[model samples]
Target: MTVDRRGVLLAGTGGAFGLYSWAAGAAAPAPKRLKLRRRHGVRPKNILVVLTDDHRYDAMGFMKAQSFGDTPTLDRLAREGVHFRNAFVTTALCSPSRASIFTGLYAHQHRVVDNNHPIPPGLIYYPEYLRAAGYETALIGKWHMGVETDTPQPGFDRWVSFKGQGDYLPGPNGLNVDGAKVPQRGYITDELTDYALDWIGKRSGKRPWMLHLAHKAVHSEFIPAERHKGRYTNQTFRYPDSMRPKVPGRPMWVENQRNSWHGVGYPYHGTLDVGDYYKRYMETLLAVDEGLARIMDLLARRGELDDTLILYMGDNGFMFGEHGLIDKRAAYEESMRVPMLMRCPSLFGPGEVSQVVANIDVAPTMLAAAGLVAPDGLAGADMLPLARGEEAPWRTELIYEYYWERNFPQTPTVHALREDRYKYVHFHGIWDVDELYDLATDPNENNNLLARPGHEELAERMSAKLFRLLEETGGMQIPLSADAGERNELRDPKGPAQAPFPPRFFRPPGT
Candidate 1:
């Protein structure tokens, strides 16, 4: 409630505009300590957050999105816990989404808009707050943010991570263990799980601990563990209806991207069949699932299964050929939506939650689980109460943003507003047309109703809401950083070409 009104809140946004006490000066520092509170009848529990990269929302066995997709560990977690059915990320890239999860701020607010951007100086991670509250924390896996350094970050007693996207198999760059270089012994997923279990086993003290086990599986160059390599080879791949070459009202940019590196037609700029790639991706995810099973088994053996808060989520969703696109960074469902499952029988019952949740909600939820209130200026709300079936005000609309990256120039800067039944996407720094989807009826997003008659008012209203949300959250200004990552301009010679000039740009003399 102590807000320094830096600017007047925009009218009708149902939000405020101000800075927290921590945002007072240049190089504003993250609060080194958090105030802890005691809750009635709810004891602080061990928290284990299992995060996977590029794992989409519906890829679990329960959803059956892919006939071959089966995640027994993930499915059991959902069955035993609360499944946030409509969880999404504000930004669909890895680093930005991870940063949002850690800071409880939007990518624009945290200023890690793209994968290459480093964690802004002085931005506090959520774990730091937990650490301050007397919780032992360890981050054991990929820390791709803060620019490529595997060095130990603050706020954790135990630190085990790799430089950017550590390989599935041990490559040149090995593991970084508490600021020391340790050779990656075996498969990355299994090894990370080993580190996590080892840490948990050694915790014979009274203080509750929190561990963030981030996995490198199911990412690009999808490599499955030796045992899971050919697990789904016999299953048939079901292509999404929207993956067809043409869809009415589809943006030209999406069409032109079909032959580029992240497209269905020529994925990876070669003859990589998306079907096979998807199979491999599913195979790669099996190891992560097994790792989760191991974690749960350990907790159960220690009589802490029901006492621990176990959460499994994907950093961001992936696209296996939706809208002629093969990767994320788009406002499409498969790209922005991610799986979020949380379990702690001592705290809440198991059921499906329809309320929309996102990466930003993670921090406040964790802090709430620890019986502490999140500091002001965090854009996310605590979902633990909501999950307990408490009647709290929930967001009716969600805002999504993805800044254009120089390395991947195919997808433009995207801004979108997602409501229960409708989604409106706006493109920036490009000449492409905007998009609107009626998700309830057109789940595939095969149609863009933005240009349709009688839908103009709806589009305008959603667009207004989108911009107002962005403005209210201090996302009106685009964050630009020095260009990093290798740029790829290659296109398939025989792939589909770009479309002609749009009519909005120029009109024939009489037409």
Candidate 2:
């Protein structure tokens, strides 16, 4: 049976003439008695997933910033929920990370490797699974998965998204509702929050609901709402110490990337000033804090505070001068790690979990919260047990893969294996160098131990493990080799090799 975009199943209703009926001669079987299992605690009847674009893990006050502005609402959420301290994304790009969260699959499995790549048409999002189990679903704010001309997949009953990254101010490039472009009148962040609250107040279902309140704030072209315009204008912002112009013993790849796309020195139009960029960035973050406050207030007023599972995360982490980089898509810690806070009063006690988890686990966790079975074929496990503080055998190491052929080519085909104490980054391209870090001793990843005599055996073991992980995850396309010619041909240096499509966008300088 087919279902319409509105989620109505297009099958015939039961009628006397319908086939496959019970035999008339069979005596009406006594109503089969089924025993219902007693639920442990109050299961959340609603879920609110608030996601921001390009938000860093350490940007909030709860993460113990030295001088950053206070994010009271987020702070409270962190205090009241189970904060995953080691949360990282499978792919550190916006679209790919979001797709991983939705599909519980890695970038290679989903085939959405970059911003311009379309999400595979047949993949089912967790919201579709939730809707199948009797829940209302709605998607608000940015949906950067693909071009807006394509119809939204059959998950949400309501959709409000744009084609790609949209501007903060209202104009022709405003948000798209369902499929029609709607001119926005106010700042995009505030408008998105307003729609989210309105939808919650007007929903007509007694069954549980899942609201995806995705925001476009804290993204590039960082512009704050008018109310937050001058909040951080006069504040003397403190830059990360790592942003210094020079650091001794830094690798050539990192030193040369000082003014690249991930670099703070890169020219971002004429509007940005190197001396004052952090001030504007802080101001832009205030709007997101305000948005969080608004969402919390709405939930409190509706008496859904204790019954809703609120999950807050960034689509991906961003870099601010770490190793002289400013954007994401790198295998480094700053770019790969994202903040994940889950507030479900019914399930988890108020505490922080330092266990490592990936963005791929988000879908199965959401499915479990809705009391539905996660579909088979997803790579992630149902993380509800972990969220509930039930100790289980978890992954000791995390695998990361980034096919770096986007508009920015500053990095290479980076395949990394990150254990608790060590990190191994294999570069499979001509333009970059391989790296290995003893994370326990060098959290900054400043030192490469690959050539060190004492670490040779350790490096060999980690390299073997990395290859094993790649083989398990179907990441064998990019081989582990240092030959520039072989690597370039394997990666198709001319353009995207897998598909015969033209380059999605031009490769900027220093990319």
Candidate 3:
């Protein structure tokens, strides 16, 4: 293997070198290495991260029949780059998951465990780090980090986001562009993507630029782009067998439940009758797929497709009637597991699938793609080698955490350990009991083996692993006792709150 002074490889052992050389050489000349460098590394010329709200891993076409519809663009990404099969979020809640992705920390370390919680003023976002390291940065779409009134968004030179979850169409609280709330006249997905493309198209910065295009589509109240409204309307939706109404057996924690975003029984407020909920979800996802294709097209058009590092991920997994629940904030695979994909045509081999990765690793991975050193305090490791299909035995197990949702009391604050074949969920609340699954044998997580005599020891061992991970992750603040109900009462006097569902309004159709 040989690497030139320009860091361009002349030859190598693995087929990766040939692939990269062919691709990169076919593109524009190598970006000039700048003198504005750090001890750790130099900045990438361009970075594009695309994030979707509340999307499950199975929803992608690459995931293969995990859901009802196909995501051709996402599938293309997976075929052309790396896909982390075991990618998961630190917290399944939207804001906390997004925060962890940016900070490379767990929700406990970041302390923004819920939607209502504000990002601590001192916490540095990864984009801020990029800016400090001499990269131009921009954040676009769906900044649910805080309420809308808090303006002058942090960490980005350019900012475009909504108050919370903004309407799909134009309304009073439609969209905000750099502190200005503007009435967008088209579909929210297209508008956000257009703004992101505009930034990339018009960028005059000599330094590297990091563009974060976060989408609001595929969230609740599944509204699709107008053209997509009738696309999947005729398709038959397959409901998961787990969605059937049944008693999720007791210690009362599993069986006893309250109103939830995705709950069993009658009169779910947002429930639609004209179409199956899952079908609507698939329809909503169409817009995201289209948006991704557009972004790729823009990159190709600008001649930056090969050099730019492109990342695609979901904030957290959403439940499509899995475990008789909706939304996230549970340790179940359906809620906790998210889709993660990366494409860096210059450095990494393509079409690799990594089995172990977490959303917390995203920041470090981005920094590594830019050849920058991740901050010392981050808990996530740089996963570039893993993404490049390097055969290093990475993590065999991952830790999961979900703080008690102050508004929704049905789901408990839980922590779990997921090894290659086993999963153990320990409920840190009084209402619930522990859960253990041999994922290799029981992939659906139907049978809980915690109380079974044969699996008791395995459960204990997994619990110990979870504890060690908690310590490693600075999750000492997480209470170990099974007195979660009392803890909730003590922590939040006005407890068991429900998130406010933002109202939907209309916008003019796009060209």
User: Please, what are the lDDT tens digits per residue for candidate 3 over residues 100-193?
Assistant: 8887887776666677655543456777767777788899887787434426565699988777788888877756678776787888988988
| Model 3 CA lDDT for position 266 | 22
Question: Model 2 over residues 417-473: C-alpha lDDT tens digits?
Answer: 899889888777544346788888988787777533467677778889988876676
How far off is residue 184 in model 2, in Å?
0.8
The superposed Cα distance between candidate 2 and the true structure at residue 6, in angstroms, equals 23
Candidate 1, residues 1-511, lDDT tens digits: the string is: 2112111122222222122222335343433445545556666788999999998999889998866787898989888899999999999998999988988888877767777766545567878878888899999998888778889987799999999989999888899999889898999999999999999989985999999999998788999999988988888998887888767678888888898888877787788888888899999998899888998999999999998999889988889888888879899999999999999999999988999899999988888888776787778888887778888899999899998888888898899999999999999987777898999998889888854456888889998988888877778876555677888767988888776544445657988
Query: Any runs in candidate 2 off by more than 4 Å, and if so which?
Result: 1-44, 147-150, 245-249, 267-275, 478-511
Off by over 4 Å in 1: 1-33, 36-41, 501-507
| Evaluation by lDDT, superior candidate among 1 and 2 | 1
Question: For model 2, which pairs clash?
Answer: 262-325, 262-326, 262-327, 263-326, 409-511, 410-511
Best by TM-score: 1
Worst 10 residues of 2 by lDDT: 481-490
Let me know the TM-score candidate 2 reaches against the reference structure.
Answer: 0.82
